[model samples]
Target: MPDSRDRKARKRDLTPEQREKRQARRREKRHASPEVRFILDNNTRVPVDLRPYSLNWDAARIGDPSYYVIGLAKGGSTLMHELVRSLCEAAGRTYIDVPAALFDQGVEPARAVLDPDWLRSRDGSVFGGFRWLHPWMDNLALHERRKIVMVRDPRDILTSLYFSHAYSHVAPETGRLADTFDEQRTQARAQSIDDYVAGPVSLRVFRNYCHLLALTRMPDFRSYRYEDVIFEKRQWIRDLAADLDIRCPEDRLDAIADAHDRQPEAEDASNHVRQVAPGDHVRKLKPETIDLLNRRFAPVLAEFGYGTAS
Candidate 1:
């Protein structure tokens, strides 16, 4: 009923406490909404449909959740998993390979949602080998548990992915997943690295990095970079073990790090350990492609302290 000037005057007349209360009420209303949306830089909205899962805090307490080590694909997850498994062995704890089990059954991380009951049953276990964060993982009631996320430079990730798919990664002789890998290999071989990294095939990798950043928003989640994990293996292992409450002798930790510290002298496309050096993209990708990747991944680079493209 009031005119525009009258409404503006009323808004300006509100006291600080009144304004704070209004903002709090708006936040509460927004949190009460069922749909959750994440807005990326290019005005792309990723809608997470949370309707199927029970997001209630009480429901999340169905079982005792294990510690989780999540990684971005081709981001040193395999090594991290091995290190965690070694630590678990030293600590006399169970290490559950969730991803490997799922992979054996032909379920890739992108195509699978972790079973709440299965997770609930694994009390006091160390769960490793996860490479993707699905929205359904939010259903887990592990707010008090320690979760580790590993990430790498997006450009390096793309370079490694190209080589892994086109050359090194092994695929089974048959199955839908094998067929999918075959298609990827064929495409990777047919296209230049620049085209492959900038094209649609690499979009999922970018999305995974976005999800990794989002997961870091949680109080219990800590993110580690692949560079640090590689260059500073002993300290990284020590810090991670302390965070997970795993007690191991310093000598044992040193032994584990020493066992995996061997780096290849040169890039070998046929082997999984192609190269461990950072900035491989500078050597592999075109200048324009690297510039485009920097702009596209500016948020991740800045957040993770990788330095933006010049």
Candidate 2:
């Protein structure tokens, strides 16, 4: 049998009739299965069957004490995660850092069987961050938990993403995933930033923003804009702390804000913190590219109080 990559390549070469036939066969096979599947916010199906066991085991033990910081990959999630970790430490709470490996491999099995134990092992209030929403999270019952979703201007996010994927973001020394990242880096280097943003990367970023927006409808969920976190550091920290019910002191808030206030003297493509300034897209992207992104991201811009006006 051909590998998945080979199958995909061959599928792309199929005629319209052949594609329809393949899709019909897939539908039949899906209907034949008794296993349950979840559709993620990104419109991808979770391949794992979620039947027989619930993802929410040990719910009473876990209870609503966990805090989750979820957002776009390059959208200040690391900064927020560190700040939350600081707050957890101050309160003597356990900070559970979910391994990126779980996400990379598949969160379905972990969520169904392992997450509760992991969350329960930590004492007191537990808080951690996830890079983005995953299909398994849909079954985790977040409404009772304190969840914050961070969003950046999709334009700035694209600018940051281009640099991160092409240069700054680190990959493993060797692996299939590392090879994929290498390919992406090469492609990103070859294309203009505008072309790179206009490609599939834009869709992924926009979908993340949409998912983040959707979470705002949950009772205990809040959304924070990257611009506010950067420009109005103190006020933003206080607001975030209040939302998460953390009694952060003025001095501590100042310390946290000061610690993360990064302003690099120069744009270093090799550095993870390439540049912290907002609206880098205005200077880097073309007029037409900016206009297109502004239009495409109008809903997100308006919802997050980001001006859509050129």
Name the best candidate (by lDDT): 1
Candidates in order, TM-scores: namely: 0.76, 0.71
Candidate 1 colliding pairs:
none
TM-score of 1: 0.76
Q: 175-259 in candidate 1: lDDT tens per residue?
A: 3567788899999999999999999856787787777776677778888889877989999889878877889999999998888
lDDT of 2 by residue, 142-181 (tens): 6766787788888898998899988898776543456667
lDDT of each: 0.73, 0.68
> Residue 178 error for model 2, in Å?
2.0
